[model samples]
Target: MLGIFGSARKTAAAMADTAYWQLIIDGVTSRLGPAEALCLPARGPSRNMWNWHSKRLHPYLPSLQEEFRRLAAYQAREAGYADPGQTRSMTAPGRGQFVVGDGAVPASPVRGPGSKTKSKKKHAREKKEPGSAESDGGSAATGGESPKVAEDEPQANPRRKDPGAGWHVEGGEEEDGGHRVFGPKFVLTSVRDDRPLSRIVLDVRYQRPGKGYGGEAALAVSMLMDAAARLPGLTGACWDGALREIHRDQLMKAGLLIVSPQHDGIAPRRIALVTGCPCGNRHDLWSKGGALREAESLDTGEIHLTPTTGSRLEPCGGRRHRWYLLTRLSCGNTHRERLDTTREDHRRGLNRTEHLRQHPPDTDSYIHCYRWRPDAESLNAQLDATLWNRRMIAYGAPQQTLVMLALAQNALTRHLHHRQAPSTTRQERAPP
Candidate 1:
């Protein structure tokens, strides 16, 4: 009986399809007596035949389809197939599994040229579970022997050829081939935080040909000082000279500090001292022969000095001298004063002084006694009035201008909107 069962099992293995083998097993089981103990192979091999045998067994079609799916899933797990939906295993033999195609496993344990032995050793060592005494301790079972220590410890500094023969150092020179000096040597005491707060010294000179104080030098200095005072963020205004002359007092009165350059030891802070010009000669006056004509009628027979060649006069060093001061003013109310001074100068010299007085020169005659002709002022006013009339005419025609302007604006807006609007219905429908 056992031999019969063994023969049946061998015959079942020889069959190509599992359903046929299962049928044969069922027939043999039915033939044996009911009392005889009977055993059968698991349903897996029989179920595998469902895919191939289902059409023939049409009465059980749905049941066979379910069994076919179940058998395919089981085979997929056993063969390590990733996708159960696929009928065949990716690891099927003779399917180029050994070749190193894209994402395929390497043919050998070696990686590249120098990787074979190291990779094998690493893999073998890793295969053993961690904390395994035999691998970690290197076979302690062999009389509990200690591992041999390496003869020489690995040196961190490897020996290399000395190309310079001790004559060179690494990074000896910078990229620009300059030696770097490291030290805090000369302290920059003047400038702090990279800002240049430097002292600029200027020298100013005054020269006058006339004996009495001509006031030109004082006026020039006052003008320069006034300009400086109008400058923004000006800290100091000073003059470096003696205060003996009356003009020096005038300079002091005009908000300028008078200090002796010799006595003031550089003023500790940044100093800019202005002095008189080195050359004593003033600019040539009366060069056009006007002053000579004016002095011709003077009764004094004593020779009168005039710049023109026609006047019989001796050269006298009594001409007026001019000196320009250099100072800075605050940015507040001083700016208003500067503007007022400029306006006054323009009104007196530009409009009024062009017309000379018809009266004879006398001791009491003053430069400001003359007035500008009424026609001059009236002409300027007419010109202003004409300009106002033209402006009014232009403004009154604003309706026509506005209509033209509106048309232009509307056209431009339409053009811009057309350019920016959606080009196609599909593009408009696309996700924003």
Candidate 2:
């Protein structure tokens, strides 16, 4: 086990897997050395013990995840980072920053207990249509030590029935051509409020992505929603093109706006009537640099957004949810355009699962926080530094979450390193 994880000066605490990390006040250092914050101490409980507790601790997963979020929020608050009204750029909205999020599937693939020890697609069925295992339970926000699964559960034919571990087919489409993964998958969401290296975790389901059960778009919305409570005065978001008019409308309902890229899908951007004053110049909606500066109305000067579509019943939403977002002109003197937020025309079909996005392609808001959106690649790199093969060293999502929250404690220590990084520059500039 030591060789697999490489040797670390590990502490003799193997039974510390089931406690809320925010409550652990002992053996914690007040300051983290840079060397310590960047590396993972290779300490893992036995596989059987981890798997058993993963099952036992599944019910308490949500609160435990919440505890970890509070821990990160506490670190950010202590370092003076949870403010939405800070400034770092000449173009960023001086008002605040947005909660950025993204999802990833690593090289870590899982196999059924009955299958061979090989990791290939031949044994794993290629799911053309969507159908994945239902989430047994448990959610992990950030990347964690994806522990090994030996399926050591004591059951009759345990190989045939593993809880929560299942097959998930991602991109095989021509657009993304993503990957096919089977095992416990996670979205690994993040929230950074005006500070750098802030890995504030958002709750993401660790279920397989198929049957449209697991998509990062839903996770992105939930991540922003979660960050809203923790980081006050969050003004807007800049995500990949996964967001739509409905998502933008929802965020607007929450007093927020998203300047994310628009993807030309089965439906097009909102159509505008040419019966207006400045309706001559129409910008291509899907290009990277297609957006123009928002224009004010020739009449009122506040905002020129006017409703063009009608309200309708929201899909899958019971009597409660409705699609009130209609085609509205881009306000100000910039002219007229709509977001086609109401999927009024289901041309071909709603390609709701095509992933990849950025802030409205080439607009100013897109450039404002291009680096803010924490995508899968960055999180996967972090895991690569921590675990071998960039995979979780834990089994089920709950257990993987414990590993994640435990690692999230590193954020506190890492903040110390970030705090002292500029003191050297200060010394260099100080006149003796």
Candidate 3:
């Protein structure tokens, strides 16, 4: 809600009306959205629509975007708690329902932002020596005679202008399948559905790299924190490899299991080394190396060396050390010890998000929970389908957020209605 302050009084025309705001939102959602979605032809009256949008709608989008965020969050919250018996379409969530967090930087499909923001490719090209042939040819071409304008190679990114857009390149070298993606990214959080082709989007975030939002992983954790309580029986979070130790610890504290198939980095897969040691001095072995051996009345304690792959349950040769769970060690039959995070946090901080799960890639969980991560991509594809390149009818972070919220609201509304329609129909058809 926008607060109006100051003692100055104004006519109704100058005042903010919540009702007018709702009306404009509904109009834009129903007509303008369907029109622009998937590049569908926009069908509506011309004169009134333009006047209402330009005079009445455009100015208030910034505020309405926030309201729309509230609307979507509230609606998704209600949808999650809906009765399973009444809404047959709702996934019969179990004691430990899973949620997934994903993010994507949709190409802005515009040209200007990249020209101003992209410096990697430019810098890479600039690394050439100043006295090199390409530089000399450039100096010679600029002087005396008319400069020759060589036709440029086709641009990999599309062109249009949206303020605040940036260039983010993904993957490896260009020749080895690397490519440039230009735009602001959006992160989405959603509950996994057992019913095929069905998932409820809970929240969305519009972001740029290093903009205080803490990238995709941070945004995902923020969403899980908010959604954890509203969602009944939330026990595990399925995520990609981008999770960090701090973020993972946060979710682990909230009583959630993390399952990620990809490794976080080339770093070792151990979450944290088990505390206490056979040496009795209690020094922890962080890196892959030897266990220190100690003996009373000896000159210097001997060093018992071993590879990292040695059993965590027992030392290399000195004495046995009890590790909670060694690297890539399965929880085995009973996973209860891990359910209580207080018991595990101090001992592990390696690859688990335990929020940014740094599990070795292609692990078994990938077959079950992790596979559902693609549902997020499906949702993204649906949103992207509506984009022409990546430009939308709305622009800017706030405006982009509003578009995302609107689409999410529409999807939930339709799904909720479908979920409840059968029961409503049965009541009407009964002998009343």
Candidate 4:
């Protein structure tokens, strides 16, 4: 049976037309579901199926992986896997299944000839800015005044200066002889389970390195939203730095990220219009006629919603593109303060070092979520382990096939274990 299964996988991976093999897999899965479908193999001398499956399904791998995860979750639920707490415990300080995601560089370790190295010339001595003195002796002519010394200021030690301070290179400008096999990058999503080091892959995507991780993260977030819908309560997701921009956009779109502490718990309720009256008479503000439109920040990052409230609430100046935070005073004087609607790559709550200092990484909701993102690496490791060789044995098998196979196994195990555990209401109950 083992030999047959391996042969079938190899044959399926190498096939020219993966549609036929996919059809067969679909038939098996439709009949048996994910857990069982993964166990059984098509009985035959399978040949060239792996390559066919990879090539055929490569284009649709992200969607296919998402669909498979949903199916696996459904199947696990149907099989008596009942862990509703994954979502419910989200409100707690440090609970919930960590949906950690990251991008991995799974390359074919084949190295080619040495890449050319370029030397960068330093232009620091070429020219000084207009305000700067030409030389230390010319400080008087340049209107340079002696530096004031503060009593509380710490003395700088010339001997203790950083050796590499003047030798630093500009970021992203350092020449890297690109990897010989800078193969297609892959994004993997997984959950941190208590059982072992291995993590269960929830979704996987393949993209060329240049495409970036933001778009891929958006897809993973969509998958997470689906899971959250199914499970409910708290579903925290952790993502690597590459997805920070897209992650923030998704959070803002889903109403997960909020600027105001009072409105943090409320979803889909942005401070549409903050109207402050000087008289301190509190009045509710409603969206009379504002269309959510895209706005660009000064830095060229895309902002999903323009701060403006449209003609109905447009300020007297007709600058309808600005978001305002209103300050209400006791005298009925309403003050409108412009609100920033710019999309930033960093999260205000999580990225602020001062905020992190107060909340700490473990206690901070966003920080805690992101800290677990490294678990996705364990999923990558598991994938490599399962793929037989360090790399994928078959073409197409790495992205979705191997991932789905691992997930199916995980779903089964989770279901079986949960099935035997006492029900929520009957926990610690005497055995029947």
Candidate 5:
């Protein structure tokens, strides 16, 4: 048992080697050719995997987990499963085990240190003893850690009550029926083909339910940006319900928006900078080519601004115009003034749900180019069945162990699929 464990550790260490990476790449090149682009499927844990103490001790575990993902994709591609433009279909007719009504992902909970709750008596006693040497300079003199703040900070969430664990949610509606998953979360992308292409780990993160979809989206977007850096033409992302309107706008603003059902909406109209105030009262207020003279949100604050191009200044409370924005019109007047947008700018854009309903990307012919997004649940099911049972066997940082588990799962499943294909085909031919 000791020898087996030691050997496993050594194997993990070798995963960081350049030669090992080249070997995997060489194998993939021989089998499938170079990888082009992919539709990534992201999955979070369904259960909790760590206590507050373990999380504190292994603060850097999440970073290590992300590194493992990059290595896994590189290795899988080398292993000949994730070649560019591979024709393998991940969701062929009988390939994925899809069930009714559970297509969407559920929400997960984040586990962090609980808020410090001290009794009223303790606070009173501390106040009365403020003059004590320990309360004054003892910590500094002894070089001890600073005293912890006792305020009742907000806890992770009341819904997440499990100790030594975090929550998990898949994408989609509330009826998705997801349970708690332990360990780290991973986003994977593989070629969509029947020959079983290699899967790449796009991103990984420590499950934080408190952040809701925000944290997960950030990590996934980061990975997408990295992949875009490597493959400039990379476009599109097939995600679950986690890709909300806010996330879509963020991706669009970053210039990475592509064809995805989740990203359906009328792209926001372009806005341009304007010079020369439309008030027609010659002044330097609009002449200065520096930053905009003033900026403020619409319908929120006391912004003395208007969209009308030119009007009698007397009736309008005799307000002196400072700056203005212009649009081309027959009157050559400023049609509108630019207003700063808040974080929740979706309200200002087209309705997302309606846009998707009218023109679904799934029905569109153009989207079939990037390969269908592999069912994330299929990978999750495989991981749960093979590796993440009731409890994880590997010890130490859960992130490191979970990452290795994911890589092994991806490798093993691809291998298993190949091994069973021949026998399954023979059985199909040998009908009764």
Candidate 6:
């Protein structure tokens, strides 16, 4: 028994030494490529344990297989097989079982521990019946019944194209061509008074052209007409020169007076003329030039004559002289002379020079005036108040609001000067 143990130990030591040497050779080959002659270290656990009797041989077999696998992998890598560990099955030498090169053994196929005839008989019994569905055809047996059809197949409805159909179809053309007519709904509310004083509600339907309004002038005219129609007590509304030519007849028919500041004609009577003024530098005032000089009366041909200045004043060509009078009324402060020129030598050169010096009669800063129309002046004052109120609310600042208030007060004071009736009355009690 001792001799047998010693022999086993010697075999294990030889196998370990062989595996250790093979490992060192594989490492050297990896760095230096394959070579004919290889030298391995003489000192190692395997070499030292050669005389040791207690060493076992079973443990060394795994190390030997591992070294062989490393050598195989190195060879596979050099041969350009990217995956060195990939397996190819091979029949073990003189054995039914197979051995994997990377240290794996093939598993034996499972079989029943019975005679060949008995195994054949068992498999035959487990087989399906000859006339069953599996043997007859690939189709499964369903008691010979046919399959039912689905219900969602395409079908035509007579009213599919009709927009009034109860069901909504996406991307379908509407029956009314998807056109909407919006009635007048906007109301002008004054923020200062916190009241909606005027509203223009149109019963008419306006269509947006597939092509939009081409210019700002058209849009402004549309917005102005729309706004004016809603306001109460608005006898007439006027538009700028850009809109006058295009919408003249239409605006006049609608009871609106179209006045163009750029036009070289006077606006018709009772129609509010909106024209550019040299004084205001805006197209807000009734007209350009002088209103009084433009006015005509049945009793008096021209209400007021244009003061002859640099040249002979033309007949005004029947243009309404209202604008000239309005200009005088607007510039009443500057025109201090009374209407009666006989009592007061209104043609005094010094007075004219002083007037010209103080308020220059230049095109840029010319003074405009209007005949004192109580109703119109009152309405203008209200409009001014409303405008100031809007500015105050829009600012929403206490200081700005106070400033607007002060401005409104000043405007109201000036407006009162033109009023036929003063808001305050001065009376003295007799000898009180």
Q: Candidates' TM-scores?
A: 0.13, 0.56, 0.54, 0.46, 0.40, 0.17
Candidate 1: clashing residue pairs, number: 16
Most lDDT-accurate candidate? 3
Put down candidate 6 lDDT per residue, 260-317, tens digits, no spaces.
2333343322212233444652122221232222222446564433332221111111
**Compared with the true structure, what per-residue lDDT tens digits does model 1 show for residues 83-113?**
2243322112111111100000101111122
lDDT of 3: 0.48
lDDT of 6 at 209: 25
Residue ranges of candidate 2 with Cα displaced over 4 Å? 1-55, 85-91, 94-96, 106-109, 112-162, 169-175, 193-198, 202-204, 212-214, 264-270, 274-359, 374-376, 409-432
Model 1 spans with C-alpha error above 4 angstroms: 1-220, 232-236, 261-432
Higher TM-score: candidate 3 or 6? 3
Mark the regions of model 6 whose C-alpha exceeds 4 Å error after superposition.
Answer: 1-212, 264-432
State the C-alpha lDDT per candidate. Answer: 0.25, 0.46, 0.48, 0.40, 0.39, 0.27
Per-residue lDDT of model 5, residues 212-279, tens digit only: 45666665566555554443323335555455545544444443423344332343232333445465
Model 3 ranges with Cα > 4 A deviation: 1-96, 112-160, 170-178, 211-213, 264-366, 412-421, 424-432
Model 2 Cα lDDT, one tens digit per residue, 191-290: 4544445455544545454547426666667767666667674555666666664565565445454655555553332232344436555432221133
lDDT of 4 by residue, 343-374 (tens): 34143332211111111132244454455555
- Give the C-alpha lDDT of model 1: 0.25
Candidate 5 has an lDDT of: 0.39
Which is better, 2 or 4, measured by TM-score? 2
Write the residue-wise lDDT of candidate 3 on 48-156 in tens digits: 3433454455468657654554554454444443222332211122312567767766666466432544345455455878776555545555554423443433445
> Of the candidates shown, which would achieve the greatest TM-score relative to the real structure?
2
Candidate 3: worst-modelled 10 consecutive residues by lDDT: 1-10
TM-score, structure 5 vs. true: 0.40
TM-score of 3: 0.54
